[model samples]
Target: MPTNYYKLNLASLPDGLYNQETDVKEWLALTTTSKGSFPPDSLNRVLRMDSSVELERIIGISLWMVGNVLPFVLPLFILASILSSTGLVLLKAFLTYVAVLASLNKFIFAPMFMKRYKRKQLSNTDIKDNQYLHTERNNQKYNSLQFVWPESVNRPALNDKPVIFTAIPHGAVPLGITCYPVWSKLFNDKLCHWTCAPVVLKLPIVSSFMKHMGYIPAKAKHIVDTLTKKEENVGVVLDGIAGMFRSDKNTEIANIKQRKGIIKIALRAGVPIVPTYGFGHTSLWKIVVDPFGILEALSLKLDISLTPFFGRWGWFLGPPQRVPLCVALGEPVLCPKIDEPTQDDIDKYHSQLLQSYADLFECHKASYGWANKKLVFV
Candidate 1:
């Protein structure tokens, strides 16, 4: 048995971890006390927090605002200036302030946030005794995050070899990918280095957080170095900035028809590609579409989403919606390690990966409340 293999105990988790209306009931259906027994109430109580938990939750959301939400405020301010009577003078002032703060983010705020997060982690006294505390700690920040590993996929033997994890439908924030720590704890602490847009590493506080979280730049050389030379698992967002524009409440679009670079990277390193989908990832934000397709073009060229978006509260404000955040990992598509894979080899593996992703979605769509929805590959 692999060191990472642990019995799936859906019953042992806390109440809010899984959405009650969805497949969580079905997940726990077979585990009724009539069969054997459930975990003790004391274990559940560990996750249930006191008054301090609320404060911690607020701070977590605030930090999220700093890292994920702050960079775009200047753009919003510019738009507001155009619409409102607010003159360009005020806007220029705000722009200058934003610039100075962005510069100071790395030197001042990033270290402070990192220290606070680390301190909170160390403060969890029960972390060592109860391994599930990893998930609990992560949920402190992301309220509705969940992981569903279908029985069809084999348990990742992290000790055996490193695997490439490809996450789909990159949300406005890609919150699921940032949950790498929780994923690492499950796989016996073998960290999967996530690849992010090169621009992300240049952002103010977000870059620091990404670097602290062990994110590699989404460059071919950097990815190849992490897989081949460093011999570690790597995770990539397949659709990236393009998918952010396509995010919608009614439909799920995977902008991956043109994404074959990662496949080639996997082939070069001889690593298996795991088709991972973050269901309800798009539900976290409401994107304002550009009918003219102008924002999409600019976003691709800039390697970042310039599309106007909003969270649960309103335009670029408030925490993400409390939707059930479930990331499902599918069976791996094995590929041969070829130093110089021809176009034929790349196309073959890419096609297999596409099928794997589609199959993964079809297998577990209904469980997460997407019964009638189909994954449209653009």
Candidate 2:
């Protein structure tokens, strides 16, 4: 999927012995050796998989799962054990059940879920105007103290030209998605909207609330229409469902390099790419599955990803921590229009867009308490 993984510019990085070519044989050879000492700021870890920190995240995620979801689902699981002992449909009737579920999900469920919103006056609040897309109608769920803006950086001035916010590394439902209005006010309420999974708006008894709140499914047509028709900006988690599974110990190894679909959208929709970075997102919650685990792979097939992510409940509302969430918005990178964009265009601009994140992290890591971190693009 990576057309040119070697286009990364290592020269700009501080000089040291880096496996730039990524010599796997050498890496395996050196795996057990005592790691040589390097300067403090030098790249040491790939994705911030620090044992202590990651362990804390893992424990947090486990508590949420074991304490929260497990209690509720355990009964259904136990019932399944009895039913399975009597030859149940858990595995034998998988195809039959799935086909039935799919049919219901499409025809009966989705329409009924959307009907509630249509019956209400929620649709009138669409933020398609060129003016600010956010407002002061703050949601009670958000605590302003948690999301702190970086003082070292100033918010970029937005214009009438449509902007595509490429929110990368899909770290634990980025605080922006959770506390949108406060997030908007933090940025002087620069009007912007976000996209979510189709499942979010397709569920029974739940879809109406999200639809009323202005969340759209992350479909290409919906994204294209929202960006162009409304003349408004949209913040998309570029990784979508797949990115949630891609989170790992490394805080910096993002999958965005090969995911050039955003580049194509920018080229076609005539929007500039804003490589927005949420420095502490990946570190917020510890997900307890392998990046390439069977659950992750299976989730991809279903167009949804699941993670029993866990974090401290108090931390969610408590005052900002020492390393609080600080989002950095980068300057817009203009893309050249091509009637039919080639691989060269995607690769070339994806590299440039990747560099923007590196620059953003390097420039502001210290003020945000990530001084020892290096934004490595793989």
Clashing pairs counted in every model: 0, 8
For 160-227, candidate 2 gives per-residue lDDT tens digits of: 36667777667654553444432233333344667777876675434564565556787778877776
TM-score of each: 0.72, 0.59
Of candidate 1, the 10-residue stretch with the lowest lDDT total is: 34-43
Q: What value does the lDDT take at residue 374 in candidate 2?
A: 63
Off by over 4 Å in 1: 1-59, 62-85, 88-142, 151-158, 247-250
- Candidate 2 residue runs with Cα over 4 Å from true position: 1-157, 182-191, 245-250, 290-292, 313-323
What is the model-wide C-alpha lDDT for candidate 2?
A: 0.49
Give per-residue CA lDDT, model 1, range 66-116, as digits (tens). Answer: 455457766777777898767567688765754654555435544554454
lDDT of each: 0.62, 0.49
**Model 2 pairs in collision:** 47-249, 47-250, 47-251, 48-250, 48-251, 61-310, 133-191, 134-191
Residue 312 in model 2: lDDT = 54
